[model samples]
Target: MDNTDTPSSARQSLLDATEALIYAGGINATGMDAIVKASGVARKTIYRHFATKDALVAQALRERDARWMRWFSEETCRAEPGPARLLASFDALSSWFATPGFRGCAFINAAGETGDPADPIRIVAREHKASLRAFLLQLAIEAYIADADALAGAWLILIDGAISVALVTGDLQAARRAQAMARCLLPTFFAPTTKELP
Candidate 1:
């Protein structure tokens, strides 16, 4: 597909249009006609690019995951490594929560709609979440946290909770609260040394 902004290719246009519409109204609400209209691409062309609507949805989600992960990494990595980097993750999330038309997480929404665990879209969503956990684990290890796996799991829960609350209440301060909780939990889980018992 052509990469230029002027006269974007049919596939790219369809993906972009579908992603925007899905983000705004969700997959079930947005139909093929709406996608075609939004993309300014013929329905036939869209079918040519994607054999089925599910395929199109999966592809759109894949693109979103790639783009979002890249942006997330850049934002979180802007701070120095260790605890600062860990806390910076929440700052990045706060910025994202404040973005115009923020609609929580696309992957989480998709997972909710696709209840079947074996569904391709659901699989993509799972992969995206796993990637997020892995990134958090890396940060925990870098911070020299004891029980890094447990800390990463706790961090993921907090992060997910913050995003959910922020989306529900439109209060970006949720991330700050989560960060504060993380700070309080860190030293307990990451103590530099433990004394031997007699």
Candidate 2:
């Protein structure tokens, strides 16, 4: 298998075109010819870079996972740390949902089309979601919230649900609604300080 990040213009173009095509259409629908035409890279060049279409798709997804996580962290971290910062996660999703050509999460869409749990697309999607959940877990821990793992897991549900709702219903307020639900659930964590003052 060829490395997609080998810092070649042809490889990068293939990666870029593959991501855009698959994201707009789907993994099953996108073809190497379309990628070649869109990227303006020759078919032989694309094959030289990526051993196969799946390899290109996998690499594109991996790169996108990194990019998406960076954007999510930056967007949510813009707010002050605490419950508000946790809630900012939803705000970040809202912003993403409103973006032009927003067609739901790349990972979710890819995984939906993939049946085999062992497929690279499925593995990439799983890893991406795990990374997202880990980020939420970190946020929960940082806020001194109890049951950080559970809260983070639930938050991941809300985030994914909101994305699905927005995509299916064209409702931009999906994230906000999920955020409201999260707010309702958050109060259980708040309580009077029990630790003795130093």
Candidate 3:
């Protein structure tokens, strides 16, 4: 019942190890022994930190969500908040794709493996995607794009699709292709007001 190590370090150690192992080997494949080995925390210590494996996994994912969203926001929203920032999302994605051990999206991967929509992990996955969609919508709204909702939805699809395709095909250009496709949609969806006409 005693996690022995300081609460913060013990909990964070489990979270760190669980995130890496789950992302690399998946929920079913990554066992407690592996986590114990990677974390160097005892079994009882893990139980003291988390009641169950699912609890540990869910917490790890929540931490991962915070970390991933922060990094993604810094990458995509660092520039001016308009069309440029919106388009820069794809560029950010491209850079991420090029990174070592890039495995597409953790949320999507987790969701695909989850059967129960009511599961905690599934909820976290949905939360992650919703955050992304909301960010895209905000950008579209700021850019005064017509039908911001629809454009944001489309961008989410394109982004997720590009990630999946890139993971499967090992083609880093998938992000660029998706971006090009997104670019074409801009003029198509954009409606200029008569007052703004040249």
Index of the highest-TM-score prediction: 3
Ranking by lDDT: 2, 3, 1
| lDDT agreement with native, every candidate | 0.86, 0.89, 0.86
**Clashing residue pairs for model 2:** none
TM-score per prediction, in order, is 0.91, 0.92, 0.92
> How many clashes in each candidate?
0, 0, 0
Worst 10 residues of 2 by lDDT: 189-198
Give the TM-score ranking, best first.
3, 2, 1
- Where model 2 places Cα greater than 4 Å from the true spot, the runs are 1-7, 190-198
**Any idea what lDDT model 3 has?**
0.86
Candidate 2 lDDT at 82 equals: 82
**lDDT by residue for model 1 over 1-198, one digit each (tens)?**
323354346678889999999989999999998998888888777777789998999999999999988898899999888878888889999999988989998988889899799999999999988888899999888877778899888888998899889988988899999999988777766655832111
TM-score of 1: 0.91
Q: Model 2 — TM-score against the truth?
A: 0.92
**Model 2: lDDT of residue 143:** 82
